[model samples]
Target: MIAPVVSAPTVSRGVRLGYGVGSFCTATVNAVPGLLLLYYMTNFLAVPAWLAGVVVTAPKAWDLIINPLVGRWSDRTRSRMGPRRPWLLAGACTLPIAFFLVFAGPPLTGVPAALYVGACFMATATAYALFEVPYKAMPGEMTHDYHERTSLLQWRMIFIGAATAISGVLAPAIVSSQGANGTVGSYRLMAATIAVILLVAMFGSFFGTARAPMTGAPEADRGGWREQFAAIKGNSAFIWITALACTQMLAVSMMLAAAPYFAAYTIGTPAATQTLFAALVGPMLLTMPLWVRLSKRFGKRGAMVLAALLFGGGTAAAVATPLFGPLYAHLTILVVGVGIAGVQLLLFSMLADVIAADAARTGKRRAGVLTGLWTAIESGVSSFGALIFGVILSLGGFIESEPSTPVQQPDSAVTAVLIGQTAVPAVIIFASVLMTLKYRLTPPVGPGPDESG
Candidate 1:
């Protein structure tokens, strides 16, 4: 039987753009840390690979706990400004400070450095949860129209692509110019700059949505964690989507973490970090419109499966770098970026569909709890990208370099970097593709919303 259609207000373009600006913050957060943090600690600061991985991932551990609590708090929250905005604003204020500090570790070394980074990063993660949980909850609350949700989120993805591209290209250039002896010198400058931009975006969303209508899960939908857990757990579609999201994030993170290593060893130009990100993400930015059209034409899942295949193949093409050259390898990754655009475009929009459906069927707004859990996986697993690659690098006998002195990695370590950059991502993306075939959710199509969006 067809489920009953749901009703919710249409999201205005200005509001969509404002809400979408929030991506400027999130994309940078996702990009810089994944792209450079572990590299900074391991290569620039001479921290051991395994230790650096731990430092990067440990802070996100708090998300496993803090996010759900924040979600619940937001769920139970009462404010004229709305439940989510206060937290969003608070997070906006603090995230930049933490961003600066993550790269601006003090004049400390060894275990102390690791501990300091871990502590500061934990603070960063907290600030991120404050903004992200509530922001994510908004779409499900804002509209129940499936197609409109896709269109609304397309703008968000565009911003994400733009922000990530900006971060990817600029961060490396800034850090390279600012770094000396492997330590972040004026690196805090880049962090501070991006932090200010994040503040603006976060605040833009907060004020833009101020006059917008807000929705909550009906009281019937409110329940203990057990009940909340069961709600998402019982939903098989959510389970599969979370797995796909987690694995896809891991693949993306691995590539970001490996970028420095790839540039250093394989490309023989670590400074080519700029070229690497530009080549990879440039295609992503350019091809977003094509991906959007594909998603609209083929349904999100079908488009996602197609995207996964392209992503896997495109990344795996790096295996041919020895036969070709750096340019070819860059082109290969460019193709992967195109595929990433598809996954990025469709996945969250599809999740909103699930949330909307749940709200309709249960007469409740549980976006907070569901999104909170989803964020835990997203943040936690994505953070582990560094950890997983670190373990592999450690196992491969990778050399640790100090400030101003680039170490010559053993051949095994070079091999490790290549595999981490290419094969690892390709293999996991293939896994995601296989899993998507098992996804059995009712595709979003056919007649009917109960109301306009």
Candidate 2:
């Protein structure tokens, strides 16, 4: 049954700006690794394709354990700054340090390199979890207005898309100009800058939002680890959405991981490749407002479905780019970017809706738990995607010592790599469409009892 919509309290302009800044900061953290880590490892560090993937993927797998623990702990946390804020602060402070370590290029020879990468990645991922989970949880508690939620998310996504565009586009250029030796330095500086920005935004949100008084069975509602697992198992919609998120993230990660290779080999020049990569993400930033409008008109689900179709169609069309020339290829990728823009913006909105639905049904706010589970799943799926792409590159005989001469690689291997980049992800995104169909939760009503907390 469709439940009555709850009116959300009006949020001030300051709160709105705070939310946007917070989102921007969080998104900058997310965008850096996904867009540039693979490129750094493969191109700059001389990490082997297979090992590069392992380094990229392993830390996310660690999140399977870390995300939930943080979520549950936050759920039980009671403090003046609010349950979610302390972690947000702690995470913000730690992130730059951890991030600096990840990109600092620690010694790598045998097990030491592998271990170093893993350890650094683990620290970075943990810091992200602390910040991201709580940051995501705050919106639901801030206001219950359905449209207000959408408006808040819209602003968050704007900053998110903007941050992603700037970071994704600029990071490669920075790394490239600095040369391999300077790559670590560039990253360190970037991390420091981003960290300060994120800290400010996080604090702004913490201070700006009105903390809804938590009256009901506070600490008791904070379920144990076993109960959290059980809750995840029980919530069909959350599970399905998470699975869809995982699949989409995998596809996106694979594409981002392989973008440099595609640019260097398929397109012919690293300079050209960087421009192409910009083309891939550039339109996304410009058209975010359009996607936001579309979502409002079509509803988040409809917008998502449309995004999957366009993204899949564009990916498939990209396969013909060899015959079509770079111009057409760029155009096709641009179209794919547009599709990605919609998906990227809408997905979080839908997630917020799901969380709100769950709260309404249960009369409990466990946004931290839900966001944690989602982020955890996303981390693992994304890591697996990177790992798979790394393996594909290795098996295809792609090398980092010199630019790939596409003619040298066997046609069959090249075909496999291309399929992994374009076709496989397209299929995964298509499958994700099906998963979303099962997400019956809507923003107005909150989640049903059957929904996962």
Candidate 3:
């Protein structure tokens, strides 16, 4: 006999849009820092490359502690605004200010500047945990249908594409417009402009998701941390998917951290950073529907495997960019972007499935804690990309200097940038494909109540 098919109620389009808009805050916050912070630290603030990497990565380590706490807190919260939205409002009120302070462009340089930026970054991490852990948990609770979850998350992918494209291109363009070398003021302006965007998006999400449905208990499991850990340990699908996602996120992070350096040293123009990001994010916007269909036809697991290959292959091909010129590099990155659309859409959709399944099986409201663990590990692993790349740059003897004094990078340093951007990320993404193969999540095989009613 054929297995019974299970589905949840459809989410409203307005709710989807309102929820998806939050990606503007999430995508821009992630993109701008990964793209520019490393370059900014070494080139603009005159912090040593290795030290700057530590400064950038260290703050995110706080996610290990804060994300789970936020998750558990929100799960148990009882309020008129809902368990998640209050934290969303809190994040909206705080994160942008902390984010802006990170690039405030103070007079201090070297260790002092690193310390200042690190502290600001830590605050941003805390605020982000407040918003993100809960925000991420919503999709799992919003709908019970597996395919519908993919459809809902498709909208999120679109906003992520748009936000990443806008921030990646706009931020670099703003930096380049100030001067070929980029002044302190250029970074400050970029930060301020993006901060406004973050505020609008975060606040918009708080109000937008007002009508979201929750399928699980209104309050979460009151069990302590050990029980939460036990629940996580038993979910095989969550374990595999988290591993796959963390690997993919690490590759993306490394590429982002290396983008500006790749543009300046490999492609021979800082302006190329805009064009490159445009290439990388442009396909993400145009190809999302295709990915949605592919997931439907091939299944999320099959589609994810295909996407991982495309991403890894493109990244590997980009290793020869110096030989073929900028156009070739952009084309390869475009391919990577197509794969990225699928990867981003499927990963979150699958996570929602895992969350919904766990809730149904256990009859507990644990979306918050599950999402908390996912974000904590993902965020921490992503930060390592910068740390790893920084060590590579240091190994190549990369020089650090202020914007007022541009210095010639050694040939080894340029080679290190290229290798870190292309070969290293390609290897990591390929590894993610292997992890994806180990994931065998199928749709839930039953019906559910209409929480959206």
RMSD of each: 2.8, 3.8, 3.1
Give the per-residue lDDT digits (tens) of candidate 2, residues 5-25: 655567667767666666755
Q: Lowest lDDT 10-mer window, candidate 1?
A: 444-453
Q: What shift in Å separates residue 445 of candidate 2 from its native position after superposition?
A: 8.2
lDDT of 3 at 439: 75
After superposition, the stretches of candidate 3 with alpha carbons farther than 4 Å from their true spots are 1-7, 216-218, 445-453
What tens digits encode model 1's per-residue C-alpha lDDT throughout 1-453?
Answer: 123454557778888888888888778988998888888788667789999999988887789998887878887777888777898898888888888888885887667888888888898889998998988888877776667777788888888888887798877777777443234775666777777778788888788877655544464356888888887777776788788898888898888888888887888877777887887777666777777788778867888999988889999999878679888988888888888888887788877877776767666667777788888888899888889899889999997776768777789998898888898888988989988776555543456633211
Global lDDT of model 2: 0.69
- Quick one: best TM-score, which candidate? 3
Candidate 2 clash pair list: 8-145, 357-446, 357-447, 358-447
Best by lDDT: 3
lDDT of each: 0.80, 0.69, 0.89
On residues 296-328, what C-alpha lDDT tens digit does candidate 3 reach at each position? 899899999999999999999999998999999
Better of 2 and 3 by TM-score: 3
Candidate rank order under lDDT: 3, 1, 2
RMSD of 2: 3.8
